[model samples]
Target: MDAQLIAFTGVSAGLVAMPGADFTVVVRNALVSRRAGIACALGIGAGLLVHVALAVVGITAVLAAVPALFRALQVVGGVYVLYLGVQTLRQPHSPVGNPQGGPTARPLRQGFVTNALNPKVSVTFVSVLPQFVPAGAPALPRTLLLALIMVAVALVWFQVVALLVDRLGRWLRRPRVARGVTAVTGAALTVFGSALLAGPLRALLRAL
Candidate 1:
């Protein structure tokens, strides 16, 4: 593989490995149940496919061109994430190692929505993926191929995280530890959402 491709792989892997909203979500679900964790990971992959589809179809460009529309999406996504954080914080701690294995539907939907609504994902695909595409290559196919690679990398990383959490279920299930995990994850989500909103909020203030 060429240097660019290698760089792309390294970058994508690094990004996937880094703890972020998706990581937090997956870990949270894993603490609940192995099934929930797997479901959440798959949901995130599915959501990424949606982003790839949009980027391939040129919606990314449209969003970039329309500042107001992009800002509106940012605001909505930010609010949704913030709400999720608050909801997580309010959930009472339960016995560790005794996962509820929540219905598959909830985590799946939550993962999909959380990932799909993230503008950063869209921006990354639109702006970064193209850099690795070879000149004269069919842009659409190349972008799709790159998206698949990213999705694969993300799935593997998330699954590993799920497995680790499952193995540590005993420790994670302790009341104090579980509460601490929940609180930290909740705070991280809130901070992430607030950071996302800051840009749009500032722009709106300037406009006013």
Candidate 2:
């Protein structure tokens, strides 16, 4: 509806899906097991749908109540995002029970849960959407439309990323740098989480 709103949503989606914890998840899935990569990608997409729906309800409810409630969500979401980053260092390397990069094996449920369980998704839906959705907009339908836009962005972007990774599978298998790559990915996830946490932590400090 508003240009600022669209820009905010675009920025949030970009940041959320970029080479942070979520991107790490996709790459890890792709590099490890092909089907799982796709599965995880699909899971992430599905998770967006769920999060947007929940966010619409949550945002609407909060809108009806205290104005300050939105900031509170931002603080909590920042903390949650940081927690996810910490998890990157120890992020599970399990192959999604799928055969190595094979089409026959797909862990759809696992993919769904992995993305669904991510706190950052909720943060996107809750804290991020409210900043963009014009107040008093047709609430339900508008939220759904915005959510669909988000989902389309995720599906298109992530699926391409997965395919790109697949094409470069050989390079990733290089002997000298594979372990190093894994270690770096873990560190990156932690950094992403830490960076996200920084903003809210600063907000919290200012509030004091």
Candidate 3:
């Protein structure tokens, strides 16, 4: 059990650290304000909990079983991310400001929706959690424990990112650099959305 827990933690750490929509969103919010970044992280943690619950209840498996529904979800999620990227790219960049450390509901909601809508996230939880469930053990408690560990690790990593980016708040305040950061993140988001769409888009085209 200990070995499985350690292995799950290590694998989850690697997954959490990978550059993705979550990382890009955090960096973007962090550059805006430390509070915003932290809010985004908390929201993502909340979203992770949702995924974990769904996986534990076997809802994720049901979603996966319905191919059309799953594909539709992927398409919607992909298009939404792509839209965000395009909007970010088009928006005029501004200096990082001292946004009042309160009223950060938007960023929080943004983080939650982004993670929650992602079919891949659902798939990952469904696939990964089963691998570590110990033989002869009650699956429910073990799965929940693993999920909690993943969320804990993710929260720590995201908070670190938020703090680090906030520390560089000054440099990011520069108009040019700030714009550059936005552009890079925007491109990254676009790429992520495109990757999600590739197979589905290809299939759709063939069916046309």
Candidate 4:
């Protein structure tokens, strides 16, 4: 493998592994059921594919160019994330197999929406990924190849996280433990979402 490719792969792995909304969502759903966890992982993979397609076609570049549009997207993403966090916090603790269901009930869609709305992913594609593509290289093929590598890495990592969470299901699914986990993840999402919204919101308030 080319040195740059290797470096890109390492960087991608590190980025995907970072604990963020995706990680929290996966863990929360994984606590519900292994199937749900895997489903969520697959959904995240699909979201990554969408981002890759958009980035490769230069749509993300357009978003980057339009500050207002990008900030609008960031605000939307933040609100969505904040909503999810509030919903999570409000969720009543239920048994692992409760038929009433939760986000885990549609883990795939939840995961997809969570990831798809994240502007940071688009930014990464627009900014970080391009650095790895050699100048004057056949941009299309090379970029696709690199994107595939990133998607694969992310899928594998999340799947492993889900599997591991499943392995610890016995303990994590307990009433008290599950409630604690829920609280932590919910709070995390809230904070993350707030941070995302902070800058744009401040700008908006200033303009007003």
Candidate maximizing lDDT: 4
Off by over 4 Å in 3: 99-102
- For model 2, the superposed segments whose C-alpha errors exceed 4 Å read 1-9, 59-111, 134-136, 190-208
| Lowest lDDT 10-residue stretch of candidate 1 | 92-101
Measured by TM-score, how close is model 3 to the native structure? 0.93
The local lDDT score (0 to 100) that residue 91 gets in candidate 3 is 71
The candidate with the higher TM-score, 2 or 3, is: 3
Candidate 3 vs candidate 4: the TM-score winner is 3
lDDT of 3 by residue, 12-32 (tens): 999999999888888878877
Task: Name the better of 1 and 4 by TM-score.
Answer: 1
Measured against the true structure, the TM-scores of the candidates, in listed sequence, are: 0.93, 0.64, 0.93, 0.92
Residue 59 in candidate 1, Cα distance off native in Å:
1.0
Off by over 4 Å in 4: 98-105
Q: How does candidate 3 score on lDDT?
A: 0.85
lDDT of 1 by residue, 165-187 (tens): 98888888788888998888788
Span of ten consecutive residues with least summed lDDT in model 3: 92-101
